[model samples]
Target: MSPDFLLLYVNDPDASAGFYGKLLDRAPLDARPGFVMFKLDSGMRLGLWGTETVKPAPNAPGGFEIGWPVGSDADVDQMADDWAARGISIIQQPETMGFGRTFTALDPDGHRLRVYQPALRP
Candidate 1:
């Protein structure tokens, strides 16, 4: 099966699209009142669909998180700050963990967005 796409159920596709467009620094590949899709640098497609429009509406909100890996701890910190400056809510501050330094933020629709820096291995 293919693993190149992810769809997020949103309360309002247009608002979600605007929020993500600014966050990602790009426009959607396709956008309508009910849906929006974005092609990331990794070639993965991220879609935002109106919750009420989905065939099987999401059972509930926030069962998953989308993660972004950066080159280093500094980068993770920088992203967290950047996102906060843009009005994104930083739910978790940057902190080092087994994997690396990381921070978590909430998207307009309350989806968890995480940025991390992988710990180096010997």
Candidate 2:
């Protein structure tokens, strides 16, 4: 089955929605006090839900990261600079990886955001 949505347990859904709205340069499809959702260009849904309202609360300070792929190395660098200018904490400086150029940043809730460009295949 195809993955349709990703839900992130956040301390405050409204605050997280505002942060993500600016970061993604788009408005949420559904924005409520306890929940928010954005429909990405790739047809995937990104959701934010109030942590305290959910049952069996998810572990805070999540360990996994969400990745965004760009078209080129320059795009990766540009995105890193943009995010930094927007006050998004840069956890890792832009650098080259085995796959391509990349950088890492953190969202307000400490979720890892990785931007990268894939290496060309032969």
Best by TM-score: 1
**Model 2 lDDT tens row, 6-109:** 88888888888989999989999998778899999999999988888777777874565889999999999999999999899999999998988999998778
Local distance difference test values of all predictions, in order: 0.90, 0.89
lDDT of 1 at 24: 92
**What stretches of model 2 exceed 4 Å from their correct place?**
none
Query: Deviation in angstroms for 54 in model 1?
Result: 0.3
lDDT of 1 by residue, 1-122 (tens): 77999999888889899999998999999987799999999999999988889987686555569999999899999998888999899999999999889999998778899999989988
Give TM-scores for every candidate, taking all chains together and pairing residue i with residue i.
0.95, 0.94
Clashing pairs in 1: none
